[model samples]
Target: MATAPLKRWVKPEIYPLFLAVGTAVGLCGFAMARNLAANPDVRINKEDRAAGVLENYDEGKRYHDHAVRRYVSDAKPEIMPGINKYFSSSK
Candidate 1:
């Protein structure tokens, strides 16, 4: 009779310990599954775009240098006195 009453009390204590263990196992399984199911399609194409930009910059620098040389080669020296007389007379 005494043993039967003791068994009843022990059963209630066992239930909470089982519940705690079950909760921990469930949370761990969920995390593992989520990690395995992550995305795999993300990527960056920076190298190709950077190569094109560098090519364009080199071409632009060459073009600008040629234009500057041509302008300097064909430039005429101004007669400052004539320019000033023309503007002063016009006003």
Candidate 2:
């Protein structure tokens, strides 16, 4: 038995029309969302922020400062004591 040709669901020329319609719809939706968000009546505030909890920026900054001081500013000799000639003050 011979295999039958597959039926075409959408025409090639209609693809551009679909794309244009989809883009216009997406742009309309985006504009609507922006306007709605800017509206004071529906505008969200820090009380209703997107994230459940805000991170503590100061805590992170303090940790970074401490790490820098401990690891970089007060760095200790890593090599064995006998081979620490380069870091030795007497050298």
Candidate 3:
């Protein structure tokens, strides 16, 4: 019987590379899920649309605006006054 060819040796670093990739993907998925749960109106799932469970365009827009306002206020409360002044001046 003919002997089988020797198996090629793979780099040991490849295992850690796979692990890092998996960790990144997992963290991304978790973050996405958390965001989706926080803002259900911004859903992009096909099933949600087909089942008529998703928000309408206007509702989604309003929700997005609200989220932006919240984020801006939380991250930089000083900016809110400037933003308000700018809008009032524009009007």
Candidate 4:
């Protein structure tokens, strides 16, 4: 049996369109996943708030403060020296 010649695959000149569409779909999926993971009802109980259970409680503020302190402590060495130098040079 005689075999016919195989056609070469034609690459699209508008290949960037496909790449942009794929990137948009991936970003949308990532945003949806983030929204699902950060469901506020699960993180902060609305029922507890309605029942006055959290009226006297400061929810997560202490943790936030601690996190801020940690961040400031870690960042000071890198940030403050730059600021001081900038100010002194500007004087």
Candidate 5:
């Protein structure tokens, strides 16, 4: 018995129409999201603000320095041998 050709969910001729529609929808959604982000009235929560500040401004330098010092002094030298090298200095 010969095998029959598989049917497509969307016809080849109409697939471009679907592609165009999907592209337009995606672009519209992206524009809307961008506008929302740009809006000044958007209120970010305190935790998010704190995290963002810490991440963007390197406010955790003190804690990180303390942690690195503590790790170097207190942690076993054999474990994580070269890991300290990465956090040894900050540019």
Candidate 6:
């Protein structure tokens, strides 16, 4: 004989309400995160930060770094041989 489950599942009407509430909570959380990201007082960048006990901090520098750009630009070009190379190079 088949046995009954330990617990009963939620009703269909209740499940939809739970789903909508969960989605609203998730959206609210995402909105808070986005707002926090835009706030300058909550700056969380570790890289390119001024090192000192009470040094002046600049958050704008984190957006663009010359060193990182230079490193990426220094990469050597790929050497693709044969007819494929000729067609690609023509573009």
> TM-score: which is higher, 1 or 2?
2
| Model 1 Cα shift for residue 67 (angstroms) | 58
TM-score of 1: 0.32
| lDDT on C-alpha atoms for all candidate structures | 0.62, 0.63, 0.67, 0.58, 0.61, 0.60
**Model 5, span 1-91: residue lDDT tens:** 2333434445588789999999999999976885556433333666655554233334344434555487678667666668776778686
Backbone clash pairs for candidate 5 read none
User: What stretches of model 3 exceed 4 Å from their correct place?
Assistant: 1-11, 40-91
Q: What TM-score would each prediction reach against the true structure?
A: 0.32, 0.35, 0.34, 0.35, 0.35, 0.34
Tell me the TM-score of model 3: 0.34
Lowest lDDT block of 10, candidate 6? 1-10
Q: Rank the candidates by lDDT, best first.
A: 3, 2, 1, 5, 6, 4
Candidate 1, residue 75: CA error in Å? 70
lDDT of 3: 0.67
* Tens-digit lDDT track of model 2 for 1-91: 2333223547687789999999999999976885566433343676656555545677455645664376766656565755675567573
The pairs that clash in candidate 6 are none
Candidate 4 wrong stretches, greater than 4 Å: 1-10, 41-91
lDDT of 6 by residue, 1-91 (tens): 1333422445566788999999999999976885567434444666423432433346434424445576867765665556657877855
State the lDDT at 51 in candidate 4. 64
Better of 1 and 2 by lDDT: 2
Query: Who is ahead in TM-score, 1 or 4?
Result: 4
- Show the colliding residue pairs in model 2: none
Each candidate structure's count of clashing pairs: 0, 0, 0, 0, 0, 0
